[model samples]
Target: MIFAMVNVLAPIFAITLIGFVLGRSKIELHAGTLSTTVLLVATPALIFSSLTSYGVTPTMLLEMAAAAILCLSASAVLSMLTIKMFGLSMRSFLPSLMLPNSGNMGLPLVMLAFGDEGLKLGVSYFFFVALVQHSVGFSIASGSYSMSHLLKQPLIYAVAAVILVSTTGIAVPEVVLTTTEILGGMMVPAMLILLGSSLAGLTISDLRPALVVAVSRLVIGVLSALAVIWVLGLEGRVAGVVFLLSTMPTAIITYVFAQRYRPEPGQIASAVVASTLLTFGCLPFLLWFAVKVLEQS
Candidate 1:
């Protein structure tokens, strides 16, 4: 188990470190442009590869879809409760507090820990999360919902592709699949490098509030996930997968939204970094606990 954890976490940590070094080196890499490129090109390829390589099953698809809906609904309710309890202003509450960076951070972590099986679940969850991020998440972040932006996401296109392949029985061409595999291979390293670079700009003062948010996200998210899985009677790997997805740190995309709509970019950035770091400690324990519980049952 220890070895497995190390094997999974080492590469992610390494790539994140590289990103940090690059960011701190005073290099002129435009973080936004690089992030945009990842979103547009690398991410799509990665999603295509994952979906094609791990053919979706009816059970897997339905369970994952249900899980995604449940998780999002839970998150929305939690966010609203937090907003009211803390007396956060609309400007402060909308963008800074809601949504997780399920793409770059969450997906990679899932792939690392759970392999192809996890990837299948992660992709399905991501599709739903992306939709919520655009619709409910965007509405919270931007103070107004925009259907246009939500409808046009590349991630949505990827989901559409999955549906098309599943429903129509269309096989991806070998050449295209090969190309996607090659390009998709670069995504993890590139994403980690970006994450590390972003971290380079972080300071102690920036992390104080972020620490609080990170703890809240982890504790609340994990507990909620546990409750949902237990109630749903998920067992073994399925339960483990749900727990991992639930415990993922705040999404980096939250930073983009925060920058646009909220005043606490520092806090959001800190939350992203803090969660990324902390998950390394928390997720393994959660996985173990889930496995133990499922096994005992």
Candidate 2:
């Protein structure tokens, strides 16, 4: 288990460390371009490629979506309870708790730990998480519900097209399929580098609140995933994927939102950093458990 954990996590950590070094060094890499490529080009391509190529049933895919929604819903309730219990501000803290870094960190972890099949499942989880983040998360942070924002995401359309083609048995052009597969292949490493880069640039001022949120998010997230799994009767790679993704750290983008809307961006920044740092300790155990679940299945 120890060897497996290290083998799985080492590459992710090394790439992220490279990004971190580049972030703090004199090199002038554009964060915007890298992020844009991951979000717009690589990720969408990956999604289309994975969905089209994956052999999982559509029923399984929908269940993954259902599982993701349940996980986020559980997280939201847990976040609200944590905030009320601690007397924390909602606008700043809630979004942080609710949104996990399922894109940059989650995708790579799934790919490394479980391969492309797991990547397909993780992408479903990510899709719903991003959807909820744009809809519910943005509304909480910005104080307005914007439907247009959700519609504008390219992944939305890509997901729809994939489903249509996949379910209908309509053959996609071989060239288009090959093209997406090639482009999508870049997503995992690029996002891992971006994760490290984001962490390198983060600024944390207070450790107290950050520690509180980080621990709560991790604990509550794990419990919630388990509860949802039991209730949904999920198992196999789907179960492992949900469990592993549930253990993911908070999204760094939460701090970006806090900086825009809230008074204490530093606290949010600290939470992001703390949770991500803590993930190094937590992920090994989570990965081991996920693999065990897969084995049992």
Candidate 3:
């Protein structure tokens, strides 16, 4: 079990470490461009191709999406309670508490742990996650919602294309599929590198608040995920993806949003790095428990 878990995680962390090394060095990477490319092209392509190729049905997509919403909502509520108790800024902490690093970390873990089927579910879950981040999460940070911005998001088009292709039962051309597959293939490595690079530059000036938030986020994530899994009665690869993704660390986007729309970006930056580092300690056990226990849920 340990060996298999190591095999699954080693490459993911190693790639992240490479990105971290690059981040620490004198090299300059235009992260904004890379991030834009991933959001505009690679990720949507990945989502469309993976869902279509895997023959994931609308029913499955809906179930995964619903699970994601529930998990996100649970995290939000738990985070709110914690935030109130601790007197943390709702504008600053809620977004981090609610949005997990489902892209860079969660997707790769599920794909490696459970293979193609896992990727199918992970991508679907991540699609909705991105949607929420743009909509509800952005609202939390900015204190206002913009319908126009949400409509203009590339992911919305991706989801629409997925629905069109899925519901119409029309076969996509092999050339198009191949192109998308090639483009989509870079999402994981790009995201991991971006994650590592982001982490490399962030320093935790104060550890206590960051630790408090990180541990609370992880705990809320696990409990919320387990509750959702038990309530939904998910099993096998579906259950595994849901559990793994729900337990992910605070997303780096949290820091980005904080920087843009709120004060104390440093607090969020600290929490983001601390939470991600802390999740590594939990990954092995999460892998084991999902494989052994939750697979039968």
Q: What is the clash count for each candidate, in the order shown?
A: 7, 0, 0
RMSD (Å) per prediction? 2.4, 1.3, 0.9
lDDT of 1 at 206: 62
Which regions of candidate 2 are displaced past 4 Å? Answer: 294-297
Give the per-residue lDDT digits (tens) of candidate 2, residues 70-155. 99999999999999999888888998887888888888888888888889899888888888877888888888888897788778
Off by over 4 Å in 1: 94-98, 204-208, 290-297
lDDT of 3 at 254: 87
> lDDT by residue for model 1 over 187-282, one digit each (tens)?
767777887887787654565566666776776677667777877788776776677777777777777677788767767777777876777677
Judged by lDDT relative to the true structure, which candidate is superior, 1 or 2?
2
- CA deviation > 4 Å runs, candidate 3: none
- The TM-score leader among the candidates is 3
lDDT of 3 by residue, 63-166 (tens): 99989999999999999999998888998899998899999999999999998888999999999999999999989999999999789788889878889999
* Reference-based lDDT, residue 146, model 3: 96
* Stretch of 10 with least lDDT, candidate 1: 89-98
